[model samples]
Each structure stands twice: as structure tokens, then as C-alpha cells.
Target: MYIEYIAMELPRKLIGSLSQFWKINVLDIKQLYDSVEKLVFVSISLEKRKTDVVRSRYNSTMRVPKALNPRLQKQLLLRFGVYETVYPVETTPSRTVPDHIEKPEYVLQKQPTVLPDKAEVKDVNQLRGMRRSCKLAANILAHVQKNIYPGITTDDIDGMVHKLTVEAGAYPSPLHYKGFPKSVCTSVNNVAVHGIPDLRPLRDGDIINVDITVSLITVITLCWHQYVNSLQNNAIKTCGPEVPFSEIGASIFRHSKRNGLTVLPAFIGHGIGRYFHGPPDIYHTLNRYRGRMRPGMTFTIEPVLSHGSKHTLILPDGWTVVTEDGARSAQAEHTVLVTEDGAEILTK
Candidate 1:
């Protein structure tokens, strides 16, 4: 299994006087992961008024100190080459979907409002629609995977996703949803999530997550990340009936910790069906969100795991989110339905 890493740097203005100190903090993380032979992913952000100190939203156990023993800086530098930062490039206008394709409400609204607090329980017909949408989403993702390699730009991938979903007589859900410009979310290397596809071409050794969503009568979303020219490990797990929703995150957290990785807690899974997103906010980190899986309820579980710090920052685009430390990160997702006996991976 290839563990993902993401790194980010503070804005240039914040690093002015404290440049050396910030570099040391970043190096400390590099050294911490180098000992385990794992790539590290981290995000650092400071309050505008308190630019001298970085703060993390993760619990005490997961927070990385602002400073660490700087003795291993040289060793880390020698082992890991200079970190390359990925930035947004010029993107073409959003593609058009045929009039026959049904669009989600957000397409007309220009923004998806905050979802209702209660999760929707799908009826029999809704479940069938969900299954069909998810199957198509999975197939499209697989089709896109075959075309991935060096020299293919992420915007190219978005075009492919848009064409496939439209050809299947379904709408590309991400289009116009909250003003996202692309048909799919293509998160390269250090971009944790909601990455807007751009003109940047895929390079060897880069990790890219292609998140696709389709809207038929019902809606379904799934994400698949590929490690270019490298083998991938299937690290996703499924849960059975009687499992509390909260425990799902706790278990994932424990497993990631044991494997020398950290979970980016800022993003969580959610209920899906007829809408792009909804209730039962599934926190992938340890949390007290209350609820339990029940038959006929469909949702997504997409936890982003990193090799370094867990903090992240949103770019000015108002959509893309990148790690603060410029480290790499990877993500995978599946839409699932609760069954009487267990859970079924609808996107599998």
C-alpha cells in the first residue's frame, strides 16, 4: 500500500523575518518520517496576527510542535530532494452538458447550500437509482484510469470525465456545484481535496486523485487516486451491521497511526442520494458524531491519509485545498449502502 504525503508552506509574506525558523520546522517533519522510510505530508497555518506560531486543529495527540530537535536537518536534506510546490495554472471554461441530461439543483443555484442536519434514508426505488448511478461512476473512473500517464494534463482528465458522464445520459455532478469549474476534482500530489483541474500535466512519480460524481435521478460520488508508475496498495476496509458510525473513524485513526501515517481530519464523508452531499457527517478522525448505519441508507467514506502534518489551507480559488507543508497526500473513496447483514460497497 502506498501511503500518501502532502506538504504546504506559509504564504511568502509570513515567512519574511522567520524564514529560517519555518524551514527548520518543515525539516523536522521530513526527518521524523525519513527514519521510518515514509514520505511525510503536512500543512502549517498561522493566525494573521500571530504569524510567528503555527496552530493545528487536530487533537493534542496528533499536533506537531512548532519546533523540534534540528540535528537531523542535513540528513533529511540529503535523503529527500528539494520539495516542489504545485500551483494552479490557467484552466479552460467549464464544459457543457447536453440539455437531456438532468442537472442537480446546485447547477442552477451556483452554490450548494449547507446540507440539512438529518441524513436521508432512501426508499427502495431511491436505492436502486443510487446503485445504478454508483455503478456508472465506478466504470467512468476505471475508464479514466486507463488513460492516465505522464504528459496527460488534469484538465484533459476532466474533459474525459465530463464526456463519459454525459454519454451515459447522466449529468456531471461537480459542474457548477458551488461554482467548481471542472466536471471532476483532480487533486495532484500535495492537494488534499477539492482540487480544481488545471493545465498542469501529470509527471512521473506524481500521485493524482480523480474524484468523479454522476447525477441521474439520484447522485453518486467516488474517488480513485493513482500513483504514476508505481504499485498501489488497497487500504480501504468495510464495516458490518451494528457498527456505530463514530467507531468507523476511531478504527481508521488507530490503523493509520500503527502504520506510521496521519489522517487529514478536516474533510469527512457524508450521506448521498438525490443530493451531492448531506447529513451524518462522517468524521474520519476520532469524533462524537452520533448515528449508526441502517439498511437502505447510502453514504460515502473518503478519508485522506498523509505521511506528515494534518493541517490544510484553501487556495484563493475558494475550491482547492492544499497541505501547508507541501508534502504529498492520497485519497480513495466509495459510496456504500447498509445491508441487513452488512455493508455493500456500491462503488466497488
Candidate 2:
């Protein structure tokens, strides 16, 4: 006998592909040997829900593939079920995550926000505290950018930032937060943000952007955004002059100038508070964010300008964001507290 199992919970996309593959390859196995006792086909139905969890069920039916063994089929079905249960629902594209493939479940699931929070600071004193956080972030990036080069591993950058932040009696915000595995984001070349520090050495002609944030007074402030824009613009204006930062920074800045592209004001700074990213997303271009800048308001200014397109890629680690076209990207960032006259760079 042969059994046919219905797979009701499978996504239509995968179901379609599997059905086609089965018909073309498995359908030709028409009969079992005289010793063949029974056959079963298990169909698993997958339903995608809002929470990134899938509800799946197994259907058993008589079939050639199923006839191999009941226990084997059961094991296969169980294994697939378990995989669907724990795998992430969203993933980076193949071109982006070439080293490690993301699970299909995560690729299909709902995504969390790119920026985490909308924390606010309403008082001037509170703003000062926020600036302190920004300064820590700024100082950390300043050191990393100055030292990044061909012989330096990304992990070195992470270690340096981690040690510096902790030495200052401050917490490196990204460590163990939301599963980010690094103290700082050192996105080199194509990697954009959240690049895990590895043994990968910075190349002579390569570019990298380091993102840092610190926590102070229960507030999370971002400091890399504005610094990126300022540095990139400055690099372009200076050409081959001494950048004080890494050569990559100068290359990105100088390349941007050659493109004759105006840094879009619409893509500049951002506010931070309870939430990691808040309103009044500042841009380098000349547009106003209705999100008012008030005292005690802390934000990040990391402007990313590309030699070609700003399109990006996510690394296998899930946090690194890189340029898609393999073009160079330059960024400097600073977390700051909004003030009456201007702003205080906390991480500086």
C-alpha cells in the first residue's frame, strides 16, 4: 500500500517549486519491489503568521517516496518540522550574504525596525548627560578611524572600542544587545553597518565606516551619523591633504567630490532616546525634519556617501551593511545633545 500525506502549511512559493521537482524526478519511480510493504507521502502545510512563527502540519499518504520506510519518513518529516520552527523568517539576499546563507523562514518573516527606539530628552541637564554618551561614542570612533589600515583586523577595532568604552566606565551599547556580536560596527568595503569584527584586514584602497553608541542615564544615544557627513565633505574638500583619519576616509571623501553629487540633505542625522532611532531623521541635504530638535534631545549623524550608488548589502552576520555596487562608502558619526546654540558631541 502507498500513503499520500497532504502538506497544508507550506508556503505557496516553496510548494510550487517542490511540486515541480517531485513531478519531474520522483514521479518516474512507479512501483515498489515485491518485498515493499507500504508507501506513504507526507505533505506538510506551512502557514506564516505575524510573529514569524509557522504553523505546520503533516499529512500522510501512500506513495513511492513514502514507501521507503515509515520510520524514515517520520524522521524526515520531524526534522523538517523542527527546522521550520526555529529558523529565522527573514534573510539577506544571496548576493549579499555569500558566505552564510540565511534560512528561508527568516527571509519570509516580518522584519523588525532598522532603528530601535524613539527615546527623548526634555530637559537641558538631561541633554548634557546625553552629550556625554555622544562624546564617548565620538572618541571611540575617532581612535578607530585614525588607526584603521591594511594590517588591522576588524576584530582589533572591536576590541579597541570595547576596551576604551569599558575603561571609561561606560557600556558598549551594541555588545550582546539584540544579538549584535560586536562592540562597534566596522563595515569595510561592501559591508555597511554592523560588520562583525573578524580577522579580515583593512586593505590599502578599502573603505570602512565605524559606528559606535554608548549608554548613559538609561538613554541610548547614537553618535556616528553626523560625523560621517562632516568627515566625507571635509575629505572631498581637501583631496590628498592629510586626513588625520585613515586613508580610506580620505579616499571616500575625495571620490565623493569627483562624482559632483551633492550630499542629499534628506539623508543626514537622527535622534535617539529610549528608542535607538527617533524622529527628525536629519539629512545632509537642506530639508527640515518636522521632528523638532529640543534641548536634551540626543541624535546620531552618520552620513554615507557612495562613489556610485548608495545601495547596500547585509553580511552573513546579519548586522553589517555594505555598499551593493562594490563602491567605496565613507561615514563619520557623532552622537550629540541638542542645545540652544548648537549641539554637544557626546562621543567626541
Candidate 3:
């Protein structure tokens, strides 16, 4: 009756603060709803297998807010059947990265090898390089974001990013990082992070995260003037040096009582320079242990916020991560330099 469906699915930590505004129901991923309902899709939680409170493993859950009309609820129950405590599961498919492009450390290694470096500040030259690479990443995302209207496939986004990154003489940072298959990360609604861009098409009212990580060690010095100058000017003007691609989802749901954007604060925005991902792991949300930003520092401030529960599930592929509740999510990231007074957005 009230705006009970407003908040996007968030983690338990934020539920206390947000629960006062909305009520929640946990549904499975296979339980499709009318895509017509704007904010009806999201990932949440529940006790699966009859009181066995299992978090996502094979079957994923999505947070469906109670604020939706009775018609929606009836449709969900009908398709999904009794909110089955014993959830029927399905196998998640996987993909591959092309051999022509360069890959990061994680692809060969069984696990992610990038770590945060503890150094407080970077040198002047280091800042310049970081700025250039971040600019490339921002530009790639900007181009991908433009093509993100309904009817476009997430895979199409990947193709565009790959072409742009290669044409710029830079590498798509995420392509083979930890065996991730795509050039850019395209997280459609209900997915948290690492949503592999595939055949899924974008829909109106749906949200997505197009995360572009670029390795510009070569590209920056070669001819950044061509790629960086054109898009760089526009990105700063529109997003104000903020990562616009990442902000789309959060902006869509920010003030909605029925749908909120829940970003992942646990994932650290690492220092990006010579190495694609390294130390000084920055916790995007609130944290007491991390150090303060200092001059010459270079790192990312990318937050992957979802439209549903903050809880997440890793797909069978091991590289792709999705919101456990099966909701829409987006990530906005920027490589920032700590200047004398404040910070500069390298990805601006």
C-alpha cells in the first residue's frame, strides 16, 4: 500500500537502516516478473530447502519488494510456485576471452594475483601515467554507455569496448583478468559485480554497470592525444569528473523508497598503475582501517551498487559474480590522483 518496495536489495548491514522504509520478499532467479514493472526486479534472500537458510550457490535469489502491486505478486507466485523453500537449481553458463588481446595476472593463475600496495603516495610521473590509463578506461565506458538503450545486448557492449580499447592502443583491463571473458564488465539489473556480458538484451527501466578497466602502459605514451583529448573533455563536463557509466544505476534508484541502489563496499578499489590492480585497497564505503588520501596517490573509487540485496553469488565460471538476490546493479569507477589540496579524477 505504502512505498514498501522502494529500497533496492541491500546487505544485512544496511537493511536495519533501510528496512524502516520498505518490506522485502526473496525470490529465485528463474522466477521472471513482468519486465514492464520498473523496479520490480532485484536480488534478496531467504531460507531455501525448507528452513535451511542457504545463501546462493546454485539457485540465486532476487529481492522483490512488497511495494509492487498484487498482480505482480500473483504472477511471481504462479510462475515460481509457493516460493519453494526447496529451490530448483540450474547450471550457469561460461565463456572465454579472445587470444589476440593481452591478459592480466589472474587469467593464468588459478586465483586473482593483484594485491594492494601499501605506499602512501605516488611520484609525479606515476600520477601522469595513472591519469592517462584512467582516462582511457573512462572513455571506453562513455562510449559503451551511449549504446545502452533497450534492445541492445550486453555482448554488443563488450564488442564496442573491445574495439574502442584496441583502437585506442590500450587493453581492456578486465578481459582476461582472473579469466573474465569480456573487455568491459556489463552488469545488467540484479547482478552485483562481474556480470559477464552475454546475449542478454537491455530493457527500458532496467539498470546496468559497464565497468571498463584499461591498461594504457603503451597506449598512454603512444598517442593518447587522439583518444584522451576528445572524450576526456566531454566526460568531465557531463559527469563532473565522476565516472558517469557507474553512476547510471545509482542515480536511477538513489531516492526511490521502492528501489535503492546497494553498492558493494567490501570490494576494494585498488591502486592502478604499472600493475592493473595492486595495493592500497580502497574500501569505497565507510571504513576505519584504510589510510587517508595523500598527494601523488593513485587508485580507484569504483563502487558496484545493485538494485536488490547486497548479498552476492559467484557463478560456476568462478570469474563472474552476481547479486545473490538476482537484481540489477551498476558500478562507477575512477582512477583518482591525490593532489596537494584535494584529488583529481584521472578517469575523468
Give me the candidate number with maximum TM-score: 1
The candidate that wins on lDDT is 1
TM-score of each: 0.75, 0.53, 0.60
Candidate 2 residue lDDT tens string, 134-251: 6667677777767777887777777787778767666666765666656666665434456666776655555566777665545566655432464544432322212221332334
Residues 72-174, candidate 3, lDDT per residue (tens digit)? 6565444333221112223223334446655555555645544444733666676666667666676666666567788887777777877887776667767
Indicate the TM-score of model 3: 0.60
Q: Which portions of model 1 show Cα errors greater than 4 Å?
A: 1-83, 110-117, 225-238
Per-model C-alpha lDDT, please? 0.70, 0.49, 0.51
Q: Score residue 193 of candidate 2 by CA lDDT.
A: 54
Give lDDT tens digits, candidate 1, residues 1-348.
111233233343433443444544232233332433433534343323222222222112212223233554444344333344567789899999888777777776545655657867688888888888888998999899899999999999999999999999998888887688889999876788889998988887677889998888745566554431011112224455556788768877877787656689999988888667788787887899887777777777888876556878777688888776665677878787888887787886
Model 2 scores a TM of 0.53
- Cα error, candidate 3, residue 8 (Å): 17
In what order do the candidates fall by lDDT, top score first?
Answer: 1, 3, 2
| Clash total of candidate 2 | 77
Q: What is the lDDT of residue 37 in candidate 3?
A: 38
TM-score of 1: 0.75
